[model samples]
Target: MTADARPSLAALSAPLVARLIDDAPALRLGIERVGGARVVDAGIRHPGGLEAGRRIAELCMGGLGRATLGAVPGTAAWPFGVTVHSAQPVLACLASQYAGWSLSHGDFFALGSGPGRALARQEALFDELGYTNAADNAAFVLEVDKPPPAELVAHIASTCAIAPDNLTLVLTPTQSLAGTVQVVARVLEVALHKVHALGFPLDRVVDGIGMAPLPPPGGGFLTAMGRTNDAILYGGTVQLHVTGPDVEAEELANRLPSSASRDHGRPFAEVFAAVKGDFYAIDSMLFSPARVTVTALDSGHSFHAGTLAPELVERSFTHVP
Candidate 1:
């Protein structure tokens, strides 16, 4: 859930984190079906891609009360499949829970064929990874740079055509299909660690951060987040409260009247001016858990924690994220 609300940094161990990157196919890791035929024609030359799709389906089914992984007696799926609820944490734990798929990294690419348009889109997807076409799969995995929705849909479409009446899409409130949530958390944890080591104040660190949870085209909860910590990356004047950019303060101020317009260094400056002192107390309702009171913490900001993942619109990365 929220690495932020975590009481101590001790929860993160180097070895535990390292275990997430294994090149194995995680079968029966609790997938819920969003709704689809038993035989989906996911078009992918890469086994990894296909497996990813299958995992999504399993998770979706689990959410719909249609199926599950374990062999529990009297389970809805019966002898073939059990039943699971669509939950983000369940999806996130898929890989870790499965250790016997025995699928190899290279074998992953051989599962399905890529259509012409899909191959073309792969170019852009690969580009998003900041890699040239020459980059191997092994090299590409070094970073988690997923393609945007348009490209991703085209890629999936080219790989496997969903059958008629199979258009259902289920999701876990805890996560998304885009695999964004899990990856983003890892990134944040790293940044969090670095900032903590440097003795950066928690509020200051969280202030500049922005988050966006991307929906999964597949059935699993693959939430993603996009952030703008550029201010910290470069030697900017304002130590951004978080990685998120605050140049939109005026706009945000206008949009959220109840909250102070604390974009980047601007709001802090205002607080400093009002207080006429070195330390200023700055609080804001700039972020909201839209479902409940404001935007979700997963949409951006760690106020809600991971367990409380709240859905956010695309614009969340700007203000609410």
Candidate 2:
């Protein structure tokens, strides 16, 4: 697909951004102007909760998807969960929601995710997806405790070819309520990312749905990050509909789970610590949903792989002491 033929993620998500700003008080999100950009505080100063995160997750997908809170059937310890679905999985999950754009300046560092990323085209992934956006406004989701520096904000606006005031920066802290939900909400995105990493043809993916148990917010950053990761690595499930040969769909199902990674057996925090906190050192394959089902749309055959590890999820969620 050509970049010109794709839908503008920023344009599609504009209504979501407006809804977020309009419902800021009810959602407990703090709205302010920082570095001339509209910053939506999902957790930093506001008491943003699960609903706020759910909405933010939709925004993260450029409003091409839906995220809902629900119960995890057959689960007791962790009953709450988030389910996500996207019809345009490649554009929504990869081009917008994947957190592919890395932004940093001084000691401040953040991975920018959302519709604005389509406008900037900073990451090489956009090239693979053959997508670009032309919009008057852009919105970005940054998982951080503090506002971005003025220089960094200016850089983001400049790269997106928009004025600072036309930019919206959403901050979601790792240890906050909104943070945990938003992070876990990436279950489908994780599966889509793993599919890309496995060299599967992105154009074959037609639709996808994923869900993961929502763990309680951890007391600190490390613990919080671990629980969120474990939720997907152990407790998550994904189903992808694709137009492809049954054998290819089967192979994709087999390779698209966290269990296929060399770094799979333990909690992510342990893996992180073993790697000395070097994210690059960890196995890229370990960041996928625990279980997956790939259905070949043309053949009407479904292939399944991996299993949920409730024990590991329980261990990670309870290890916060």
Top TM-score model: 2
lDDT of 2 by residue, 1-321 (tens): 565677788888999999999999999999999789999999888979999999999999998999999997424689889999998999889999888889999999999999899889988887787776888899999999999999999999999999999999999999888989889999999999988888999999999999999998999999999999999999999999999788999999999989999999999999999999999999999999999999999989999999999999999999965
Off by over 4 Å in 2: 1-5
- Top candidate on lDDT is 2
Tens-digit lDDT string for candidate 1 (206-304): 332222222222222121222211111111111122323333322222232212224322222233445554342533332221111112223343222
Candidate 1 Cα misplacement greater than 4 A, ranges: 1-141, 144-181, 187-191, 197-214, 217-321
Clashes of each: 58, 0
Scanning candidate 1 in windows of ten residues, the lowest lDDT window is 133-142
Cα error of candidate 1 at position 35, Å:
41
